[model samples]
Target: MKRMIFFSAVLGIGAVSACGGGGGSSAQPIAIDFAPLGIPNTDQEHVSYKVTDKLIVTYSDGSKKEFPLSYEVLLQSGDQMGSYKWGQLLDVNAQPMSNIAYTKGEISWNPDANSLIKTSDGKYFIITHFEEPPGMLYASELDPNTLKVKSITPIDFSSVGGTIINCAGSQTPWNTHLGGEEDYDLNSIYSVSAGGKNPAYVQCTKDSNGYFTGNDVNGKSNYFCGYVGGVQRYLKDLNIDPSNGYLGDKFNLYNYGYIVEVAYTNGKWDVAKHYITGKYTPEMAVVMPDRKTLYMSDDGDYKGLYKLVLNQPQNGFNKNWCGTLYAAKVKQLSDQNGGTFDVSWIELGKACDSEVKAIIDKKPLLTDIFDVEDPSACPTDQGFKLITEDRINECLRLKVGQYRSSKFASDDEVKKAAAFLETRKYAAYLGASIEFRKGEGLAYDPDNNVLYYAITEIGGSMADGKGDINLPNNMCGAVYRLVLDQNYNAYKMEGIVIGKPINRDPNDPDYQKYGQKWACHPDYVANPDNLKYIGYNTLLIGEDTSYHINNMVWAYNVKTGKLTRIAWVPTGAEVTGVFAHGLVGNNYTMTLNIQHPFVDTFRNADGNPVNSTYNDQNKDKRKGILGIIKGIPAGLLKLTH
Candidate 1:
C-alpha cells in the first residue's frame, strides 16, 4: 500500500507533465464537488469520504493551526480470513464488514497497509502509511469495547527518535510488525526523481553528484524542481514553490531508509532498527522458517534482492541487532519472464548498531563507508580511500550475482561497501543482478514452501535497453515465484502469473467493445503487486496501474492456476494491501485503504480523467475510501461487460 512506486512518485507531484498527462496534481483550484457513483443507496456511510481529524497546519507567521484534514486512500484491505470482514478507514468511519463501498470525500489520503491481528485473548489490527509516524513504535489505543481511538502512546525507538518515511511493511510469523523506511533521497545522489516510486523503471532524465541538465519535452529541466540530488541540502534545487508550501522534509533526508521491526507482545509494543539489514529503497522483508534467514525486496528498477542471516535467532527482534546482511547474485539460466535461475548470496558485512554508528560519526561522507579500494588496481603508490561519483556509476556494468566472491578480491573493502554507506552500488560492484522492476510486496507460502515477488511492470520503454524482461510486447506486469526447499533455499524462481496487455491501440473505437472479455482485463492479472498468501496456495494480488481503467485485487489459485477478480476500487483508485491479517475460519477481516480515487472530472496518477467511469460517469469525484469486504469466496468472481 505504501509504495515507493518510482513513476507514481514522479506523477505524485500531480502538476508535473511527464510520460503522459495524468498522475500528478493539477494547478487549478477545486471547482466541482463530487459524490460516489454506481452504488444503490446514497445514505450509505461508506460512500461519504469526509474526515474530522484535526491536523497540525502551519501558517507563514510561524503560527500553527488545527485544521480539519482529509486524505486520499491509496491502498486498503486488512486480514481477510475472518467470518465477516470488518473495515476501518483512515479518515472516514466505516464498518469492517461489507461487499460494496464507494470511496467518497477527499478529506483523508494515503493510508498504506492494514493487518488484522486476532488472538484467543482479543482481536486487534495495525495500520501503516506515509510520512506520519509520530513515534518509533507509537500507537493510539482504540477502546477495547468501542474500537474508538482513545489515546496514543509511544512503543519503542524513543532513543533514536521516532521513524520517518514509514512506507509499506509485512506482518511477521511471530506477531511483529516490520516497516521499511523507503526514502529515495537518502544517498544525496538520487538514482530516482524527487519523491518518485521506483527509479529503475521510470525514465529519469537526470542522476547526479552534479547539476542535472536533462530537459523535459518542454525543454525545461525538471531537475530544477528538487527532483535530483547528490549534494548538500539538495532539495533546495527542486524549485518547489514556497507559497504552495511544497518544500521537502529535512527529516526526509537521513536516518530513514531502513527496515523497522516492531514487536507486539504481552500487551506491549517495542521497536528496533536492524542496522545490519543493509539498506536500499526497501519495500518489504519476508522471514524464512528458521527466522534467522530473511529476504528483502527494494522498490526501484534495476534493484537487487537482499538477505539477513542472524548469528542466532532471538524469541523476537529484542535489543539484539547483530547479524550478517547478504546481497543476492542471480544466475539467469534463461531469458524468459519466469526463467529459472541459480541463486547465490554474497556476504556484505556484519555488525550491531554501535559499529555502524561509529563509522557514521567519524567519516559520514556518502562514499566513506566503502573507503577501501582494490590495492591491486591502485595507481602505484596511492591506496584506495574514498569512491567518487564516476567510480560508483561504473558499477552498473558488473555481472549480476557476481559480488565479492571472485571479481572483487578486497575482503575488507567489500565488507564496507556491500554492508554500509552505499549498498545498492556496492552490490552492483559484486555483480548482483539488478533486473527486477518496481518490486513491491513479499509473500511466503509456508504450506507450499514458495515465495512470491511482484514485478509490477515488464515492458514498455521502461523495460528498454539492458534490463528488459522482454515478454515480446508484454506490458501489464508479471509475478515471479521462488520455490524454496527444506532449508528455505530458493531452488526455483520462475514466472507463475503473467499479465496480458490489451494490445489494441487506445484510440481505436473497439477498445471499449472488447472491454468485457478477460483478454482485455487480462485473463490472469494485470500489473500485479503486493502479494498476500492466503493459505491453500492462493495469492491475493493488490494492483496499481494507469494502464487499467481501475486498480483491483485479483485472487490467484496457485494449485489451480486460476485468476479471479474479487474486489476493485473506484476509478483513479488502487485496491491495495489485500491483507490476510485477521484470519479465522472461512471468514476474515481485511482493512483496505482506497487510495487517490478521482472524481469523474478528476484525474489519476497519470493525470488522466477518471474516464467518466466504466461503471457510470455521472458519479462525483472519488474521495478517500476505507472499507472491508467479508467472505471473499475464493475462485472466479463473476464479471460484467
Candidate 2:
C-alpha cells in the first residue's frame, strides 16, 4: 500500500526532548526508540496517538512517558463534542487495549445526521483513529457525553488487498462514510454503514483487482499497469518511452487513475468510470451542493480541477457509484490577448462533449498555465497536449473509448508535443528559485465553501546551515486556501497573503491593492484583507491556538483567514495533511507519516500515474490515526464509552 501523506515535507528540526514521566502526573520528556513503535519509517508513514487512559509517548531517545488517564481531559472533550462521555480504556475482556494500526490516517466525527444513522443501528459517534494507507484502521467509538469508545472496531480496508493511505471521509448522498485511499495501485473507496461490521463496508470493486480505464484513445500509463516503483519516475521524469524503455512500454498508468466504491453487502469494490480523461488525475472527492455532482482535484500532470457527475442514481441505500466524468475549466480574461480562458471549469452539457473530444486529440495549447495574473495559465514552458474536440467526438461516435496508442508516443510526435508544451502557460510559476509541492489533505468548508490544501517544502536543494536553525533543507511548509468566488466559478491566489508578501503580481491590478508580492513557496489564501499562509500540508483550525504538528498542519482560527500556530510535532509523528470529517460531527482529523524528501504523485499529460522516490528511507515509523477529541478527559476516552 502506497501511503500518501504529504506532510513529510514539513521536517522541522527541534531539540529532542526526553519522554518525561508515566501515567499519573504530567509525564516529562523521556526516551523512546522509534524502531519498536512498529510504524512505517518512510516519508509516507506516521504514528498517531489518542489521549486515552493515559498519554503514551515513546520518545526518540529511548524513554517512555505515559500520562495518567485524566477525567478532566475527557470532560473537556465531551464539551467540545456536545456532551459528556466516557468509555472503558481496557478491551472487552479487560486487556491493555493495544490493537491500533497506523498508516495514512484521519480523524473524523459523526455529526447529528450521521449520528442519527448510527443511533438507529445502536452505534454512536466515533472519532476514528487509524494509520492511513499502510496500517490497520481502528476507530475509537466514544460517546459524545462520556468521551469513550463504546466499542473498538477496526476500520478495515484489507478486502482490496491494500492499505488505506490518505483518505477523505466523503459525506455520501445517502449519509455514510466513503473512506478513500492514497493507494495508486489498489485505489479503492470503502463505506462505513450505520450499523454494520467492523469495517462496516467493503471495497467498492467487485473483485480485488479493481477495474479502471482511461476514456481516451491513446491508451494509459504504467501507473494503471500497477508497476511497483515505476509511478514515481514515470511522473517526475515527465517523458515516457513507448518502446524498449526501462520503466515499461508506455504510460498506461493513466488507464488506472480512477475512483472506486466499497460495497457493504458483498465484500467487493466496483470502479467508477473515468471522469476527466486526459492530462489529469483525481484526488479528494467532494460532492457539490447539487449532491449528484462531485468536485475533484487534479493530483495529476495537469494540476487543475475537475468534477464527477453521477449519470445514474445511487442505487438507493445499496451504495452504487457509477458516474460520468467532467474536467474543471475556469473562465478567465486574458490581458495578453483580450480573451477569456476557463481555468478549471468543465464545459457543460453538449457544448462540452465535442470540445472535450477535440481537446483530447488536437491537444490544448500551453501558453500560460500558471500565471497568477492569468488565472487560466500554468506555465507556457511545459503543459499538456490534449486532442481536439472534433477528434474526441469522432472517437465517441465510433464507440472508441480507450486510448490505444503506444505507451510512449513516436519521436516525431514527442518532439512536436514537447515544443508545443514548452510554450504552455502556468497557473502559478515557481521560476528557477521557486517550486510548489502538490497540495494534499484537501477539504472544503461547507459553511464557507472554501477549498484548503497543503504544499510541502521538501524537495529543492537547500543552502548550508546558514538559514538552518536545526536541519538542512528543513521542511518549512505552507498551507494554502482556494477561496471560491461568490459565484463559485473559479479559485485563485489573488489577494492571498503568505508569510511577508501578499501573493499578488505587481503588474496585476490587485497586486498593489493587496500590497503583497511573492506568494509562499507552496500555498497561500486570502480572507478579506488579512491573508494567511498555510504551509503545504493538511490543516485544522480551532478556536484559540493553531497546531503545526510535524506533517500535520493544525492551526487556530483568527475569525477570518488569519492563522497562528498553537502546537507542533517535530519528527516521528509527522502529519501529512488534515481533513474535516463532516459526518464525524465536523470534528477535524489529520494524517501523519514518516519524514522523507521525495513523497508525491504525478500524472502524465494523458492522465498517467506517477510517484516520487526517496533515497534514504526511514525504517521504523508506520501509519496510524491521530484523533483530537476536543472537550474530554483521558481515562474515559477509552475503546468503549
Candidate 3:
C-alpha cells in the first residue's frame, strides 16, 4: 500500500498531500513536461556550447545566456605521468614559480578560517593525494588579486594527531575546512611518526594470527593502515591499524571518521575532530542557516543521511562539540524516478566532546586476552587488541534500547559505545534507514529550509522490499531533496532529478542487449558526486562515475526543473571539488578540478584523437584546476523560494 502511494506520487506523477501520504493510484497522468537541460557536453575546452533542445528554464526563462569561463591553473601534481616541468605553478603575483613540490591532486581553495600567520600572502588552497606514500594535505598560498601561488607547505596533522588520507571537505561558516576521507570509517593511524613535520606511514599485509607487518623503511617499520581485522580498502582509504594511532596508538581509531575541522584561527592551520556528528563514510557537511544544525552525507553501503543539532550555535565546534545526531527515515510520498516524499529523523545518540575524547583515549588499550586462531572469537575479537580483539562485539555486548539483550547493563553504555564507535550499526539498530549507497555532497536553501543530496547509485536502498518503493532503477543516479521543519529536521524526502543513459550503440559493451542490463552515458553526467547551490534554488551536480564517462559537472534548477551540463573532464577521471568562491555579488568565480586525467593522450576506437582534454603546453599531462564565473540571469536573481 505504501509502495502504491509512492508510485502514485513519483512514477504516476501524482501530487503529494499535506497529510504526506499517497492517496492517488499509480498511473502516469498526462501532466506538464519540461524541456531537457543541456546538449551533450562538448570537449573540455573553454568555449560556448548549446543546450540540448531550446532550453526553456522556468525561472531563468529561455533567454538566459551561457557565458564562457576564463580559467586559471594554480598548481599541478608532480607524479610520474605529470605534465609541465612538474605540471605547473604560479607565484603570488601570477608569476611562474621555479621551486616545485609533490603531485597533490584533489584540490580545495582555502583561507577557510582566517589564520594569524600567512602561509602565503594571498589566497590559501589545500590538495590531497591518493595511493601515494605518506598521503598528505598541502597548502599553497596565492595572491588574492592575481590568484597565483606564493608558497606551498605540507600541513602536519600530528599536532591534532592522524595519518589522514585527506579527501573531500566543506568550507564551514566558521571559516574552517571540515575534510572527510572516503572509506576511512573506524580505521586508526597509530604510528608515533605517522603525520608530523616529516611523516612516515606503514603499508602492510596482515598475518593469520591477527597482526600486520610492513616493509622496513630507514630501519623503522612502516605503519599499518587498517585495524587488526578491519578491511584495508584502497589508496586514499583508511588502511592504518587501530592498535596504531593516527599520530600515535593511543591517539585512536574513533579519531579518523568524523569531520576533521582544519581551521586557521590563531596564526596556524589546526585540526580537531568533531565527533558530535556521528561518524560514517563521511563525504560532505552542509550547515543550515541557523548554524546550529548541520546536514552530513555518508558515501558507503547502508549509509544514511544524517542531521546534527549542536548544544550551542554561537560556540563553534572547537569549543563545543556536544550535539544530538539523527538519521532520516523516508516515508516515500512519491514514486517517480525523481519524486518527492516526507522524511522523519530518528534520534540515534548524543555526545559531548570530552566524552568522545575519553573513547579515543581508550582506543589503544581496547584489548582482551583472547586466544589466536579461535574461530569463535571472530565477531567478538574484531575491535579488541589481541593485537586487536573485536571491540565492536564488546560494544555490541553493551547494547541497549531496542537492540539490547543480556550483554548490556544499561542503555547508556549502548548509546555511548554506538555514539562514537559503531555509528552506522547503532543507527540501523534504532530502525534508521541504512539502505543508501554513495550519499555524498550536500546543499541547502535557508529561506526554504530544504536540503539537497546526491545518491550516486540508484540501487540497494531503493531495491525491492526495502521501503516498498517501485520506481525504475536509475542505472545513472539521481539527486534527492529533503524539506526540513523549522528545527532543521526532515519532514519530507524525495528524488528531484534522475540520470538517463545516453549515446548507446549495439557495439558498445555497456549496451543492454535485452534492455534488462544497462549502463549510463560514458561521456555525460552520471553517478553525481559533489553538489553546490548557487542561490535562486540552483543545485550543481558533479560526477564521479564508473560508467567510463569522462565525468562532467551539471546545474539543476530546482524552480525550473532543468539539468544543464556546465563543465566536463577527460577519460579515466572524475569531476571533483566544485566550490563556489565566497565573493559576494551577483556574479562570482566557481572553483573546479579536472582530477587525475589520463596521463597519455586518449583516442577513440576509430583512431581519432581526443584533443580537447590534453594540454599540449605541458608535456607530462597532469591534473589541473579551473575557475568558472558566469552571470546569473535576470529572472533568476529576482526569484524567491
Candidate 4:
C-alpha cells in the first residue's frame, strides 16, 4: 500500500505524519520507536587499511574523522617521498618544505583530503592523490582558524605519467591548474603551472593519432610537458574521425567527448579543441558568463546534461574552436512502481537524429555498448561493458529537456517537423538499459534555473526511518529537481512536476487521467508550494564493496529558489568505483569537482563506518563518516538566475 506509506514515513524516524499513505488495515497503529538523524558512524577509521576510501575529514560535530591509510603512509612511516626538483616540495634533508609540513607523528597516517579549490590569491588549493605506486598530486594549505590541514605540496603522478587515471580540473583564463584526462587509451591534459611566469610540464597532441604512440617523444610527442607561456599544448582528442576535417581521426575515436582550449599567453602551451562533441563522457569542462559557451557533465551511462555552443564570439582568455553540440531530452520517465510517477519526454528532433547518427555511423566502443548493472557482478557477470563505440557513444549522451518540436513551427510545419523524428522511443529506452541506480552529481542553479540531481537511495527507510534497509526498496536512488515553468521560460519544456497532485474526483472510482504522475508526497512538503526537499540530497544505502553515495552536486537560488550542497570527492577516492563527475573552471579559480583519494577512510569488513552499519555483517568495521553543511558562495553563485 504505497509500500505501507513509505514504511510509515521512513520507519517513522524522520517522521511527519509518517509521510501518509499506509493508513488502512485498521490504520496499523503502534510501532513507532524513532530517533536517527546523526550518530552511529562509531569512528575508528572504518577498519584495517588500504585499497579505497578517497579521503574525508569534515568535523564541527556533524562528526567525522577517519583515515584508512594510503601510499602505506609514505611506505609505512620513516616518511620522505619528495623530488619535484624545481617546482619545490624537496627533501631527503635538502630543505624547501612549506608545501606539506608535517612533524608531530610523521610515521602513521593523515593525508585524507582529496579535491578543494580557491586559488588566485584567495588560496585554498587542497588536491590529494596516493593509493600508492607514485600516484601523487598533494598541494594543501588551509587553517582559516582551524579548518586544519596546514601545508602540503606533493604533485607526482609519475610527473604526469600514465596511471594517474582521471582528475577533473579548471582554474584558467590564465591563473593555472587545468589537469584533465581519464582512460581512453591513457588520456592527457596537464599544466599545474607551479609558480607561473612560465612554469612547465605540458602534454597534448594529435594531428595523426597513433594514440600518441605509447607516449612518443622524438617526433615531438612524449606528450609535450613544456611550453606554458606560448600555450603550445592542451591535449586529449582521443580518436576523432567524424568524417575527417583532420586533426587526427581513427574513425573519430568515439569523438572522445569535449573540453580542449589550452592557452598560456604568448610564451607557449596554446593547444586547441576547447569544445566540440557528439556527446557522451565530455567529462568536466565549464565556461559560460559568455566565455563563449561550454558547460559539460556526462560521466556516461546516459546520466544526461550538456552544452557547447561556441563556433564564434569570444571572451575571457580568447581561444574559441568550432562548436554546436546540445543533448538532454528525456522529457519524462520517473515511475516508482506504486505505479504512477510521470514525465515521459523524448523528442529533441529524434534525440538529435539519434545522436548525430550514432556519432556519424560507428565509433562505439566503451566495452561493447549498453548493459551497466553491476550490483557486484554475475547476473551472468555484469552487462553493457566497454573498451570502446567510443565507449558506446560516450554512454548515451543527455543534457536536458525538449527532445524535439519548436522551431517556431510554420513553413507549413517544416516537413512534418522533420518527419516527427520517426516516432521516437526515447533514445531507445535510454540506450538499451542500465539504471542499477547510480547517476551521481549534477547542478546548475544560476539562481533557480532549477537543475539539481543526486540519486543515492529511494527504497529502504522505515525501521522507524533513519537508515532502515529492510528490502523491497525499488524506486532506485533519489534526490531530484527539475522545475522550469515560470510560464515555460522559453520552453525548455514546461512545469516539470515534482509534487502536489493527488486530486481525485473525476466522478470517483479512481479516475486517474494522466493528471496524476506522483508528487502528492515524496518528502517535497510544499514550499512556494510545489514540492520541496532539495537540501543536501541522498540515496546510496549500504554495501556494494562498501557503503555508498558517491559524487553529488547542487547549487540553486536565483532570487530565492534554494537548494545548496556541493562538496563531493569520492569514487572510492579514485579507485574508480564509478560516480565519475564533471564541470571544471577558468576565470580566476572555479570549483565543483571530484576525483582521486585511493584510500584514507571508508570501512566495513566488520570495522563499521561505511556510513554506519551497511551490510556484509560489518566487514572489519572501524566507523566514523558523515558531514554536511557548506553550500552557497561563488559570490552567491553568479548573480541573477
Best prediction by TM-score? 3
Candidate 2 lDDT, tens digit per residue, 1-641?
12222121111111222223344344443321111112122333322322223333443344555433222211111122222121112222222222122211122111100111233343433322222213223333545443344544433333222222333334345543433333333211111121331121122211122222111123423232222222322122233322111122222222233333322223222222221322222344555445555555433112344445555444333323434444334333331211123335333221122233222244222211111112133233433221111001000010011322232243333222221121111111111111122223344544455555433332231112211111123233333455665544344422121322232355754344422211221122211110112222213421100111122233424234434332222222333222222222222212222222123222211223322222124322222222333421122111100
Q: How high a TM-score does candidate 4 get?
A: 0.24
RMSD per prediction, one decimal?
16.4, 18.2, 12.4, 24.7
| Candidate 3: regions farther than 4 A off | 1-68, 79-135, 185-251, 315-319, 338-340, 364-414, 467-471, 502-518, 521-524, 584-588, 599-619, 624-641
lDDT of 4 by residue, 1-641 (tens): 00000000000001112112133322222111111121112222222211222212232233332322112111111223343321222222323322121111112122221334444445554443221111123454444333333455554322111121122333333343333232222111122111221112233333353233212233453312111100111123254321222223322222323333333344323333332333333334444334445444433232334444555545435433444444343322224321122222322232222333333234322211222232222143322222112122111111112322232223222221221211111233333111212233333343445443433333322111221112234232333454544421211322222222223455532224322222122122111100112222221111112222222222233334343332223323211111111111221112111222223233322233443222243432211111111211111112111
Please tell me which model should have the higher lDDT, number 1 or number 2.
1
Measured on C-alpha atoms, candidate 2 has an lDDT of: 0.28
Q: Looking at candidate 4, what is the lDDT of residue 307? A: 46
Who is ahead in TM-score, 2 or 3? 3
Q: Over 4 Å off in model 4, which ranges?
A: 1-211, 214-250, 258-277, 283-355, 358-451, 454-572, 575-641
Q: lDDT of all predictions, in order shown?
A: 0.47, 0.28, 0.47, 0.26
Name the regions of candidate 1 deviating beyond 4 angstroms.
Answer: 1-108, 117-123, 131-158, 190-254, 265-268, 370-414, 460-473, 505-512, 515-522, 583-588, 599-623, 631-641
Q: After superposition, how far is residue 40 of candidate 3 from its true place, in Å?
A: 6.6
Error of 2 at 260 (Å): 4.3
Worst 10 residues of 3 by lDDT: 1-10
Tens digit per residue, CA lDDT, model 3, 34-67: 2333323344431221212222222112222222
TM agreement with the true structure for every prediction: 0.64, 0.42, 0.66, 0.24
